[model samples]
Target: MTEVLFYHLQNMALESVLPPLLEKSLERGWRVVVQSTSEERADALDAHLWTYRDDSFLPHATWRVADAADQPIILAIEEGNPNRAQVRFLVDSAAVPADADGYERMVLVFNGDDADALAAARAAWTDCKARGFTATYWQTDERGRWQRKN
Candidate 1:
């Protein structure tokens, strides 16, 4: 199955998502990869998700292009939010590209708020689509698992 997720992080709370998402994904035998728009954002993600800076997600997030073949990868978008404890805590305002060689499977996890963040993620998604990879912007609609541009 091919997938690309651009869900909204309403309030920047790990409790808001992460746990259930990661648990469910990993259980399904998927390898995860994370990408941050900036080094600071990557660091913050490390501080928040990995509980340490030298962890898998932490290091992978910094990589300009990360390929996790035979594994699921998560590219965490770093929107500059001040309050780390809450969502909407996007501190910096620029979004960088997350591109690299090798591998074709990816799930771009990003906050749906900030225009910049959305733009950056969209670019990556577009790249995914261009590369002939199964790509789509997904969200929960009235039913479930909505993927299609409207």
Candidate 2:
């Protein structure tokens, strides 16, 4: 069974939140594919992940790269998993991919401030549950700690 997680971002930006999660995923030896809504956003995330922190380094490439299969992380706008990742991250309001069941986990990170994103996340949660996934919801507390809501 696939474990689906819904991360609800309140005052924080995706740029601030995503790198740490990706790091954790890598620490667990899981290859990742982060899907965005557009090529521009994917490009921006590709750049941000490189310099998100001075001490941190995320080995990644866009899906367009010839050696994408060699990267641990791949940023893409489309649905295919180029790196044979065990985990897939849906960001920037990207919808859940059709191949969601292929991964060990599927993470949907949505901006709480954006109405469309919030609605989309809700819909995705319902869809995941209906698909028989073990769905969990998380929200940040006052000090920026993740608290499981359900």
Candidate 3:
């Protein structure tokens, strides 16, 4: 069964929160696929991944890039997993793919301040549960740390 994690972004932006989570996934030797709502969003994240930290590097490529299959991390606006990623990240109202069970884990990150995002996240949470996925919700605390809400 796939494990689903929902991240309710409050104090910090997705840029601040995503890198650390990606790092943890990489540490576990898991390839990752980041899904964005649009090509523009995926392009922005592709650039952010390279410069998020001056001292660190997260090797990743956009789906349009030539060597996508060779990358451990892939950024795409679609649902395909060209990199054989074990983890899939859905952000900015990206829809969860119907074939999501292929991945070991699925993560949904939404800004709490956005009413549309909040509603979509809630629907995704409920849908995941109905699909028999083990779902977990995480929220940012006062110190900007993640804590499981349920």
| Candidate that beats the other on TM-score, 2 or 3, i.e. the better one | 2
List clash counts for every candidate, in order: 18, 0, 0
* lDDT at residue 135 of model 2 (Cα atoms): 96
> Cα miss at 121, model 1 (Å)?
2.5
RMSD of each: 9.5, 0.7, 0.8
What is the per-residue lDDT of model 2 for residues 1-150, given as tens digits with 9 covering 90 to 100?
A: 899999999999999999999999999999999999998899899889999999978899999999999999999999998999999999988988889999999999999999999999999998998999999999998989999995
Compared with the true structure, all predictions reach lDDT values of 0.44, 0.93, 0.92
Q: Model 2: residues >4 Å from true position, as ranges?
A: none
Local accuracy of candidate 3 as per-residue lDDT tens digits, 1-150? 999999999867889889999999999999999999998888889889899999999988899888899999999998898999999999999988998889999999999999999999999988899999999999878887889986
Angstrom error of the Cα, residue 18, model 3: value is 0.8
Q: Write the per-residue lDDT of candidate 1 for residues 1-150, one digit (tens) a residue.
A: 333444544335433355455545556654454544477665666556555334334222323343422234333454221111111112232222333223223445566666776677677667656655565555555544434554
* Top of the candidates by lDDT: 2
**Regions more than 4 Å wrong, model 3:** none
